[model samples]
Target: MIWNLSICFMSFIFLFLTSIFLMFLGVVFIFYDLCYFIEWELLMLNSSSIVMTLIFDWMSLIFMGFVLFISSLIILYSDEYMHGDFNIDRFIILVLMFVLSMMFLIISPNLISILLGWDGLGLVSYCLVIYYQNVKSYNAGMLTALSNRVGDVALLMAIAWMLNFGSWNYIYYVSVFNDSFEMRVIGMLVLLAAMTKSAQVPFSSWLPAAMAAPTPVSALVHSSTLVTAGVYLLIRFNSIICDNCLGQFLLLFSGLTMFMAGLGANFEYDLKKIIALSTLSQLGLMMSILSMGYAKLAYFHLLTHALFKALLFMCAGSIIHNMKNSQDIRYMGNLVLHMPLTSICFNVSNLALCGMPFLAGFYSKDLILEVVSLSYLNMFSFFLYFFSTGLTVCYSLRLVYYSMTGDFNCLSFHPLHDEGWIMLGGMLILMVMAVFGGSLLSWILFPSPIIISLPMSLKLLALFVSLIGGFLGYELSKFSLSYDLQSLRYYLTVSFLGSMWFMPMISTYGVNYYPLIVGLKYYKVFDQGWSEDFGGQKIYNSSVEYSQYMQWWQDNDLKIYLISFMFWIIILFMFMVI
Candidate 1:
């Protein structure tokens, strides 16, 4: 206990200090207009060499600082969150390794190094998801790992294609070869990898499924580490994707992802999965703008979204912990009466998520909406973006109504109170950031404010939809005993929307259905039927029978010795006669 607690304390201090230090370096790097690289040769072949390279610049440094800072607070949060678990030490180590892996991904411009971090995130996340040691956790972990493995395969292909360039540092060469078929293919593969990581469209099921993990891991994964890795990569490769066909492709799917995820979250009853789906929706918004050539705005949203989302997850974790680990929001109502502090933090973070005026999400989300309006894109995409924006607000308000308002529906003797001060301490810190992170990030990221000229109708459109969505969210949740639930009348539509448009089904059983069936057939035909006669088991039996037959010769060796002597004497007599 003492050792584990010490590890948490020590890590918080070390990482907290490092985050501040790196933040200072980030500002300095930006001020000086400087970048540095360190290369250590890992392998060399006649002309082509594989090198582990590290880059130091404002972007990587600042991103790393935020990641570590959140990780520090999460470490503090988890110390109390996983208090009595026998494997608390292991949990801490995994989280620390997760942070390190992210640092690896953030600092390296090399595809090879990024793969190290990418695969690490996938693997560590699987371990974290299954940390609970239950069937659901195991299944969710498999889904998460397999989904991420698709991205890994895509990245590996990208790396293989990069072999044509003689160096893996695409940062120095991608723009030069932007028109080349090779670079285009690499961009597509990178986008595919990004899609899987970011949980866009069909690959999105795993993000919500991963809610089976601990909330601290969810906070980290959703906020800064796993999901955002894809968006960050796209931001770096914005040069190649701008105005390209791949950008259009990303726009279509990201818009769909944003729309679908928001709709799904509104239908979801599980508290953590609702939050997880919201993360997916936010990632889609980021990707959609990046596709439209606003990488800075995407990155701006990424940083701000991280702050509130992390706070939101912490508050949810606290609620779940006190609610007897019940994640069902149906069991939670009138939480404001019992846990006033948490309710304050929860609503504030949710409002930030809804892009409430002057809040963290507002600065980024509103600016993104305005920028999309300014750009000339297809009408279909524009509709998806605005409607998805409304859905985001709709779900935020719906979740608030279901989980925070109404009557308390939990067990009569529920643990309906706030958590320890340690947990609240982390929540309070992030809550403050959720309020101010957007403006701070906007100032630091863009020295000069972005100005957009728009008509009054266009400018007020976001606000208008937000108000409408809020009304719908509340009205949809308000039910009397005689009220007809639309879900009952439209079962298929509700199920389709609620289940992430059958994406989980498609990603899980749908993709592997045929392969699993084929494996079953092979097992019946080869292992059970034909293999008995043709495979190793038959060979083993034949060898044993042959050995038994040879054993008789050994047993009769003494008797055969006398017969052999007589035969030899007769053969000698015949030879003499000849």
Candidate 2:
């Protein structure tokens, strides 16, 4: 007990020290804002000379706070959660590496540094996902690595294009090429990279697969770190995306992803998988908000989402841990009775996630809706926002009902106790923020000067819609929805067909990978021809065949060696003569 208490105390000390360092970093970032506002060209240029200059910006500070907060929570949770687990040292190392990479990623001032951090985060995440190295975890890690490679390639292409056609410095590159066609292309490519990284739309399947990993990894990656990379990219290049077609594309794609992921979450039985789907949906909503020229709103959502989502995931982790690693929601029921503290934390986070009034999600989600409503690009975007909100409520309620409220039926699984005080302490901190985040935002975070006033009516309307939607979902949840196999089949077929068409469009236009199809055909032909000529199965069967052939060759080896040597000598002599 003394050792355990000491460990928990040490973890808290580490987190507190880290938070102080991050706060100092945030203060340093304010100086960059000053330099940018003053138009100090010399300061701007020389700022690139020093690595510390990367720390100077409001955006970087905001994201850095996000990284620090989420990472600290995860670390604290892991202190107890991973107490007796083997490979604890490796887990802690990977967790620290993940946090360091994300810190560097948000603060990097140049594309090269950003990519370095980006790849580092990907590498560390891959390590964490397959920490156990079981077959399923290994396969999940491989898929994650491949998807991240795709995102990295797209990001590299965009960086290359920017270097060739625009400036190389982060702010300069965005400002100098703000109105150019190449900038638009770069913006679109960056969006594609972000989509893949954030698990948007067709690229979203890997996030659920990632649930095969440990819950701590899921909490870290999905809740706060890797999944937010795309949003960070967008936020970094907000100026470039604001006046381009890429922004419109993001709006549409994000809205669609939100709706689709929400629908999928309603059908998911796995607790972590449902939370994974929620992450995708919320990220889509964030992207859509960013698309509508509301960087502040998007950032607001990002901050709130990180807090509540991390809390939810950690609480889910605690539950899973209690249940001896069972992830199926069907096996979980009356958990509130079994684990009251976790139940309260989970419910609080879920309420925030559902955008209940006065919660963190409520403020940011309403703000996003308000921004979209005011912009009102078209009927499609408007209706998409409405539908997405309704679906968000539907899935949020679905998760809460399925996981917490059902009758306890599984006797084979023993009732487990709550997490340690340290775990509960971390959760309680997040829960307080989740409940009071909106008030904090309004009272402190919003711009003081108020250069532009938001639409009051639109804000009110969005809040009303969100509240009504949640109520509707609660009512709908009173009766179980009947499952129709035929309807499910039809929906699956349509989704698959739509994705088939949609993938090509997004790849060709959004991602700018039109040559992929041609490359696929060429690869197919190459594979087929290789298989036909090689007698594919015979190679594995014929290790001794090579030995026999080698023996036969030995009989003629002297003659063949002489001929080969002479041929090489002749070629060399001819080259020397020439």
Whole-model lDDT values for every prediction: 0.90, 0.75
Q: Which candidate number has the best lDDT? A: 1
Top-TM-score candidate index: 1
Model 1 stretches with alpha carbons more than 4 Å out? 42-50, 480-489, 521-578
Please give the TM-score that candidate 1 achieves against the real structure.
0.89
lDDT of 1: 0.90
Model 1: pairs clashing at backbone N, Cα or C within 3 Å? none
Cα distance off (Å), candidate 2, residue 361:
1.4
Off by over 4 Å in 2: 1-12, 24-53, 165-167, 449-464, 471-578
The TM-score that candidate 2 achieves is 0.79
Candidate 2 lDDT tens digits, 1-578: 45554554565577557765755665455534532222222343544632333644666765676677777777778878888875666677778788888887887767767888899988988888888779988977877787778889998998888776544556656767678788777877888888888877678766777788778778888766899988988887888887867778788788888877776666567899888888988998988888877877787788888889989989998998887888887777888888889999999898788788788888788666765666657988887787778777776776677668877646776657788887888889889988986667554456453333567765566556666666766676567555464697655644443243244345335543457776777777766656644767457558678888877887778899678879999999999999
